[model samples]
Target: MGFDARFLELHAAMPRVSEADAATSVELDYVHFSVVLDTARRLARVTGVNVDGASLVELDRGGDDWQLDERIPADWQAGPAVYARNDLDRGHLVRRRDPVWGSPEVAARANAETFRYPNAAPQASGFNQSKELWLGLEDHVLAHASVNGMRLSVFTAPILAAGDPAYRGIRVPLRYWKIAAWNSGGELAAAGFVVDQAPLVDTSEARTPLPGEVPDLGPFRTFQVPVADVAALTKLEMPELVEADRLPKTIAAAGWRRLETSADLLL
Candidate 1:
């Protein structure tokens, strides 16, 4: 739907963000995916639309030339720029050019929000490219309109640096991801999943885990969340709502409530 009310109800805790700003629009199940992230990590993004049904659309933004913009929580902070050193390109979830979304500015923001190093997986440039199989799945899921309430899932585990506190719990160098979304009761609903399977990549451990104890995230599961929700969760931290947390929320307090998927049909 153009306006997502289900998203609003699910992510009421997060500040509203523009479809133009970087963010997700819905949550989905991971087990249903051919692959999944086994780690006990979480990624709650706010869902938005960018069409790529015809083909993969790579963003025009790239390193050095690309600007870094973010809305961080005042009390929380990062130790340093993690992805600064590496052949890893800033990968994005929301493509900047999709027919559903007209202007490049809005898609730029959505792609930007997912640009965080935490949201990235250590991939060969070929693997991360939009034309690749993995990225193709992402576009398919994003463009899907399930006939039933069933939807796909999309979630990710941060690829951490070796010896860093965040990697201590990780048994595998590969990260995790899940995605799912569809329509219900005249509104669109979404869910996300996590499982101990299908590691997307294998690289040297880049970070240390907390207390040096590997975390068991249990079995694959699901949760409903808004499309605009993006919490600064690492491999260790759990996600929660902050009354006034900074984010794209820094832009303004606007969110979709009972958002309409097909405004023209509804009208």
Candidate 2:
């Protein structure tokens, strides 16, 4: 129920805390995480999910029942109405496939946990070139994991910025981030990425709220940024995880790579 020991085994070790406001720690069936309930926003500033790749079975595409976490006050998290008629998608921070690799019974439970409203975030409604790349990064890593014994540990959350556009009582985060770690030949290695949905998101305060409509702002951009930079932007203390980055310390000197496909990923 806590951060799974299996997660630590895959991360090589636990990284530092990412959010100072994490007021609640909730352990799901297969994942362990903490959330900062933004009472004002009716959402989370940070909802960190730790997943163990070894426990993953196959991608479960079955129907999901999205529910509010009874473990916490329902008002503390977003509900389905916020997404109604809004051009936003209820994105799963812990990719549904990541936690499905266990026994049929165990995997079924984990798959269901992935749908809780607390585990969901508001994302730009539709996919674009950048969104596709961002969504596929995990699959690419998993493919490479075959050589590393198919193991991984991932951390993900929306970049909850004060400047995000407010709509229907919730602020729409313009960006999201992910940090994936794995062990290779007895050493810890990790990669950090950020996906910007800014182009498709309208921040104008005067815009009318349309629940089911998302503007086509154009193709989004995905970047392979420095782990240190991710830590700074998200306010997550990830010193050890940053130290394990495969990218050059001078990520700027080399320039962050614009990811177009899995082949473009550094890891």
Candidate 3:
């Protein structure tokens, strides 16, 4: 099975891709998550996963191997080739541990499914302040959700901006976004965030590396943004999530709030 739209008490539909790009996009369902791959960009347009904090399972990832999904052509995915001989990391859009819940066998399958290339995005290898904060967001949200029903629905994807610098026939995204949805008491609650590595990514032609050259990328800058802003930026239709946004309207009017730590989160 894949991500359940009704995983939470309230339903959260998967983000939709635009009609123009729909033809080239392939939706693939994994053990506990789903990815809508933008073949044209050789990356995922959106990925959704269901996390059950109460049932989470811990398993060692000692010998897992990254592989392409056999259902889709290798060319349609930004596989090992893009990350080969570079500082770019094959980042997981749906963090591996999020979906690795349920039974031991099921958790193992979920863990393996995460290694498929469609769920991977190219991110800077170096860790910095913002990147470290970005990586811890899900855990913080999960803990918050535990007070309610211990279930969460998370959506994530690269911005896929046209201006992103080109590398190995694919454009490297400078920004990525995440939306976490859960039930707060009897109401649906959600928060949106954007993390940028623009300064680290030198887009200048002279600095943009030739094939096989490692492109220089800088530290990440994280922000708590409006869900509506995320919808506008990625051209995804997610009215419900926007309406359920837990970020204060006052902060939304003030614009994106730079987040130095989880304490900066309004949710």
| Candidate topping TM-score | 3
The CA-based lDDT of model 3 is what?
A: 0.88
TM-score of each: 0.37, 0.83, 0.95
Q: What's the best-to-worst order under lDDT?
A: 3, 2, 1
lDDT of each: 0.30, 0.68, 0.88
Q: For residues 84-158, what per-residue lDDT tens digits would candidate 2 score against the true structure?
A: 775678888777776665578767776777788877888866677778878777777777543266667667777
Q: To one decimal, what is the Cα RMSD in angstroms of model 3 from the true structure?
A: 1.9
On lDDT, who's better, 1 or 2?
A: 2
Model 3 segments more than 4 A misplaced? 145-147, 200-206
In what order do the candidates fall by TM-score, top score first? 3, 2, 1
Flag clash pairs in model 2.
18-236, 55-101, 56-101, 57-100, 57-101, 85-211, 85-212, 86-211, 86-212
What's the lDDT of the predicted structure labeled candidate 2?
A: 0.68
RMSD each, Å: 14.2, 3.6, 1.9
TM-score-wise, the better of 2 and 3 is 3
